[model samples]
Every structure is written in structure tokens, then in C-alpha cells.
Target: MYVLIFSDAGGAAALLVVRGCHTALTAVVSNRSNGAGGNFFCEYDATHQMSNSKGELVSIRALVEFCSTTNCNSRQSTSANVFNDCNDQTTDYLLGNEVLNCYECTAQQGKNCNEKDRKCSSKKYCTKQIVHLDGGFQLSKSCSNINVLGIDNACANYDVVTNPGGVAVHNKYSQCYCRNKQLCNSGSSLGVVFTVSMLLLVHVMSTVVA
Candidate 1:
């Protein structure tokens, strides 16, 4: 069985416990704007029947059709099970198909200088990378697909090098991936302590490898 929770702009809330494989479900909603708020209870059984709070078996399809013609505004509805409550998971499900906006810029443009907002698919994450090169550091903030980076949803440090005219040049970088909020890559630091710890870990690993 699943619980369906619904709420509207006028402070009306509803909870429905449904069972069986019925094509239509009846919901007895009260008009809160007219100061007529009262209790509304609805349940469905395995016999493909629905009953209202008055213990009257009403036609599910007819009730739904009646609601549609009315001026009631039910804003949100969520389907929840026992294992999970109605919170972030429900919001995520509602926004699953929405696009994400992220700040897009590079270090060359200056710090915290976002030229435009990058529109990314819901599956992509906003990324921030700090590269420590020979001269100085380079920062890049943009939206990235996790599959293309071959990385998980966390921060990581890595090293890369190039050989030019028999000379070797190496660069170390820290990249962080986030999707919890919009424009998250615009921050100057992920966290001072966290950044320091990651740098120290990279140093220790490099020493061990050397």
C-alpha cells in the first residue's frame, strides 16, 4: 500500500491510503478558503471500491471528474511508502525533469566573475577545480557530467605532467563536484579546513609515491 499526501495554497491538506489496482481514486477535499475546513478521510480496499468518511461507497471516477470541474487548487501530491518519508525524495521526484542553472567562468576572467549561467541537465553536477601550476594557480568553474569525469560525487586530487624538450612540468589539482544547490561553484573555498586537509593528503600520497 502507498500513501498519497496532497496540499494546496489555501492551507488544505489531505492524506489518502490506497490499495488494489483501481483505475480511479476518489478524494474528498474540503474548501479551506471559504472557511469550511473540516476532516476528510478516504480509503480504498482490495475489492476495487472506495469509501468516503460517511461510510458511503462513491464512484471513484465520478468523484475525480467532479473535482476537476471545481475551482479547487491542489498544488502538490506525493506518493510515499513506509521505508521513506515525504521530504527530499518527494521534492526530487517532482523536479526530476527540471534543468539546473550553474555559474560558468574561468580564472582568467577574475575571481567570482561569472560571465553567464550554464543551463545543465538534471543529471549533471556543478564542478570547481583548482590547479596548482609552476607559476600560480588556475581555477575553473562549470557544469560537468559525472560520467565524463569518471569520478564520484565528491572532491578529489590528482597530478598531471607534460614533457617539453626533455624537461618535465607537473601540476597538481583539486576538483570538487556538487549538485545540492545552484551556483555552488562560485564560492572561493569549499571549506578552509577541508581544503587544507585534502592538500595535506595529496602531499603525503605524493611523497609516498616518490
Candidate 2:
């Protein structure tokens, strides 16, 4: 149990008389505080942190230094040659692999973070990109056309925030999901704005029939 409390004592009045038998275990209910009790202070290990399945943000799960980007944040795979499935351990705990992809990214489309580029090691397939949900970003280059590419043109005038009837692509090269702004029909650049609003509504109905 922490090797019988760091080998059974050495001041804090002999660890407050061995495991605080007289009460005083003062902070090691850990989230990171190795600073006041000299020599690897430790406690509170709920296996660190790993929350998912609908809380949204998927990566930061821990282990090692109680990992949230520590105990050596294992930085190697941007798509390190697409093999799949990997688990690690040094101090051992670096958590979060209950599954949803990125064991080196074959992609369930979450955190594939560019998969070591160079077109993902020449087509082992990650084609090096994973950004999704309409800034649209992920491309390994296979599908040349079938539509579904929106979110460019600077957010297409920034109106909808969440699901305002599905269809958007405001123009970063913008090309699909055109359901509004009159179906984004600028193909003829909106036919000169509908022929100058139909010639200014036929000259305001010929000046109200003269």
C-alpha cells in the first residue's frame, strides 16, 4: 500500500505516526501536487481520468503521471503508417482506449490528427487528415465526387448555429449542402441578382399604371 507508506516513515513526525494513525494525511488525494512533502508524495488514484460515450470531448484520458498530457504524452502517431491497435505502459495507465478509433487511425473519424502526412505513408490509408463536421477537413483522397463538402465562404454569412434544417457550405472553396440563401445558387452568380430584381419590379409597375 505505497510500499507500506514510503518504507514506513521519515518525518511529518514519522508520517504523522505511521499512516496518520493520529489523523493527518494531508494531500496526496492527488490531481498533481508533489511539492510540499519532499520525495514522491502519492495518493488518490481513481486510475486518473477517462470520460466518454456522450460527454463530447473524447481525448485526454489518463495514466502514468495521471495523464491529461503528462507522464510522457506519447507523441508519435499522426498516422504512423496505418497499422491499427496499440496500448502502452511505462508507469502504466495512460488510459482511454475503450474504443472509437485512433489506435493509429483507420478512422472512426474522431482524433486522427493528420496521421503523419506524406499522404499517410503512401496509401497505407489515412491519406493524412481528419477534421470533419463541416469545416469539412478530412481527406485521404479517394472519393473525387459524390457531393457532401460544405462549410467554406467564411461560414456562408454566419447565421445558423446548430441544425437549422441541415445544409451548409459557406465557401472555403465551398461546394455543397446548399439548402438556403435560395439554395446558394450563385452558379450564374445568381443570374445577376434575378435580373436586377426583375428590372426593379417592372419599373415599379410602370409608375402605378401612369
Candidate 3:
């Protein structure tokens, strides 16, 4: 089974295998128990399911068995069968589609830059490529009214370079304004003058011909 394990709170990692991706999916069995709500451990057996969505963050909960390795023996399992006690109460987090970075790869795990935390605080993700700080970049200090995505509290796509030796990830952007439709229509008045000039030119040519 293809299982992915990540470090959570208390420095515990588990390999959970799932069928689908980027969606909310679950599998329940009769011989299993569930734990408290709003917390996630690790699940490695048939009774364990990991739900990861690229659009929203789903809270994981189980009455029992957060981390389990399949039992080749017929022994009944206890709550302490996994671990004597839990170390971290809340240490791990999963991003469904927030676009904040730290993806499912080594590059995301070991990012390129972290010094410009203040600037990239809400702008770019941890997985996104960093740009070297130099000219040709619109600094975060100059941004106003940034846009927000479906899950983002602020708009996505603003970036700044802290290092001079950074690589490009996606199309780098700073900030841009979006004007209202009414304000833009006011500029349509300019087109009327051009139309009137063309009609006058046509009239002058006709009179001369007559």
C-alpha cells in the first residue's frame, strides 16, 4: 500500500494509505473504535483513513486507533496498544488548498528561503520558489487591497525575494488594483469625441463633392 507519513505534534509520524485524493473520504469498520474530535493521530491499517483536500482543510477524528500496524496475530488491541501515552496534543497540520506552501515533496519539506518571513508571511507558500531580493520587484510595503482566495484570509500571489540566489516557481506577482465598472465607464466619454470627428469629416467631404 502507498502510505505517506508526516511529522505531527510530539514528533510522531505514521504511514496512512488512502485511495482517493484532494477530497473528503472515509472508511469505517465494525471491529474498530473512535477517539475524541478535532484531533488526528496516525492510521496505518484498514480501519484508518486519511482525508486530504486541495480546496479545504478537513478535521480528522477517530474514537480509537490513531496509529495502527496491521495485526498478523489474533490478539485484541487496547488504546495503549499503539503508544503508552500521547506526547503532542496538537502538533501536526494539513493544508488542503490554502496555497501557503510546504507541499508533499522534499523540496517543500526543505524550502529554499525562510528569512523573509515577515514579507512572505501571507503572500507566498512554503513550497513556492523564492526570488532573490533586488530590483524589478514590487515590495510588500507598496501593496494595497490584496485579493483573497476561497480559503485564504488575504489574496494569494504576492512574493518578495530575500536571497539573491533563488529560483522561479510560478508566475511571480506583487499587487494589482481592480477598479469598479462604473469608474471605468466614465472613460468611455472619450470614444464619443472620436465618433463625432469621423462624422464631421464625412460631412465636409460630401459638401465639397456636391
| Candidate whose TM-score is highest | 1
Per-residue lDDT value at 105 in model 3: 14
Error of 3 at 208 (Å): 83
Please identify model 1 stretches exceeding 4 Å from their true place.
1-98, 109-112, 115-123, 147-153, 188-210
Question: Roughly what TM-score does model 2 have, to 2 decimal places?
Answer: 0.14
Residue by residue across 9-114, what tens digits does model 2's lDDT show? 1112221112221111111222232312223222221121111323222222121111222222232223332112212111212123221111122234444534
Residue-level lDDT of model 3, residues 1-210, one tens digit each, is 111222121222432222221111111111212223223232221111122322112222221223223431121223244333222222222233332222221112234323223221111212111112223221212111111111112222333222223443222332121122111111121111100111222211111110
lDDT of 1 at 189: 31
What TM-score does structure 1 among the candidates reach?
A: 0.36
* 2 versus 3: better lDDT goes to: 3
> Considering summed lDDT, which 10 consecutive residues are worst modelled in model 2?
143-152
Lowest lDDT 10-mer window, candidate 3? 189-198
Ranking by lDDT: 1, 3, 2
Q: Cα miss at 107, model 1 (Å)? A: 1.7
Candidate 1 structure quality by residue, lDDT tens digits, 1-210 = 112322221223543322211112211122211111212112111111222333233322101101222333231234343212212212231123655555655553245545464433343456676667666766666654321122224555566564445556666767676655665566643341122222232321222110
TM-score of each: 0.36, 0.14, 0.15
